[model samples]
Target: MYDFNSINDYLNTKIIGQTIIQYDNLTSTYAKDKNIFNTCPDGTVVLSENQSKCTVRFGNKWICREDKNIYLSIILKPIGKNLMISKFDVIGCSSVCEAVADTCNVECKIKWPNDVMINNNKISSVSCDFVGKSDDPSGVIISMVVNANMGTDEIDKINEEIKNSSTSLKIETGTDVHRELIIGHILNNVEKHYDEFMKQGTIISAVSSCIHNSAIVNKTISVMKRGKKTVRKLYAKSIDGEGRLVVADEKENEEILSPGETIIIYEGKA
Candidate 1:
């Protein structure tokens, strides 16, 4: 488990992760009710060494390994009307990607709907949703779980159970990194894009950053329509302004699929 003082000392963000809260174990980081949320200021980060509960974006069990991974949530209060949770999905990926690169010297890919992968094996999973009552001091919680330092056997087991194949910082780099440092880097990267979103009030830049680090973009990959196992081969052109995936075929005919309706798989070559 990472120390509170270490994470706090390492973080230097403006509006994200300004307050670091850690627990020895919890059901979930963002599991608090409306009353607790009302008291917590915006940018409060919640973390745990062992999570006994909760699911990711697709309702898949986020397998928590004791002291082997990083699972945390950053709270942002007073979400604006009609906020697109999709934008935050990619922004979370961007933050995780940048953090992985910063701490582990590893490049990552974005599997649609918030699975960050390295070599087609998942390194992180993200989720965002409005917490607290709509009428109260509610806000969006962007939660992520990074496979920071899990061992190979534990990583392998979760991979068989989860949709994406799994890998960890320890597995990929053959090294165990200080999880606290990675958390700090992720907070900083998140704040960078959060500032842009607040200032520009747009998803273009957020989508662009995710696209740059995209695993499926500009690649010939397998596309499985969400809710069914049926998969297709398509050329991923890019993610559009609305964060929808733009995929094309041999003759350049294109189909834009919403994140909820599409699942992408990266087959090694073509």
Candidate 2:
């Protein structure tokens, strides 16, 4: 397992007094573990190298890739209103995409709710779980898992199974990258965005500007409903005050979607 000190030391130079923890493996989901530390402090991060079997299962496949990606969860205890937990998923993906874009110069676009894609391929997948009392909904535990190791061969195999639906950094950048460094950059960016959201009210002007400057806006998208076989064409109307995708249909009717529902933004017109 990597040293927690090293992770903290690296982050300290970028962010002051950010608390972090490391684990060899975890038996529970990142959300479950984060809740255990919910009341701790802000910027408290818990990282595990390997996770239990149950934690790896996502639908039909195991989300764990062992040494291939950064498996991390963070607890960001923000004050004020309990912002929509769903928006954090967008914040997380946009942060990762910005970090990866800076490092690799690959055009990264966020696929609706929580996947990041580069050159029409998927480079990262993000998930978040929220735990807090209704009376005081400010406490939130957000966890994200990113795939940094999916290279050409892995992408080819995955594409064969799923058919042009997924991608990785190695395929777009044509080079191997360090998962830890990417994780650190992603965390930094996420912290910056989260801070901005807290300070600025969630009006369309403020939130849309942040998301547009990041790479999720103006992309043609397809929304994949949970348990459905087909994907639908939808334009990203705007990221809501809470960060959910406010997408529109061919008729320009808008719909607010939950983060758990699968969404894929196509690189080309659907």
Cα-based lDDT for every prediction: 0.78, 0.62
| TM per prediction | 0.86, 0.76
Report the poorest 10 consecutive residues by lDDT, candidate 2. Answer: 54-63
TM-score of candidate 2 relative to the true fold = 0.76
Candidate 1, residues 158-241, lDDT tens digits: the string is 544463466788988998889999998899888887777777776666687789888778888787877788888889898876
lDDT of 2 by residue, 167-224 (tens): 5566666777766667667777777777666677443432553466444455557668
Which prediction has the highest lDDT against the true structure?
1
Clashing pairs in 2: 87-243, 122-167
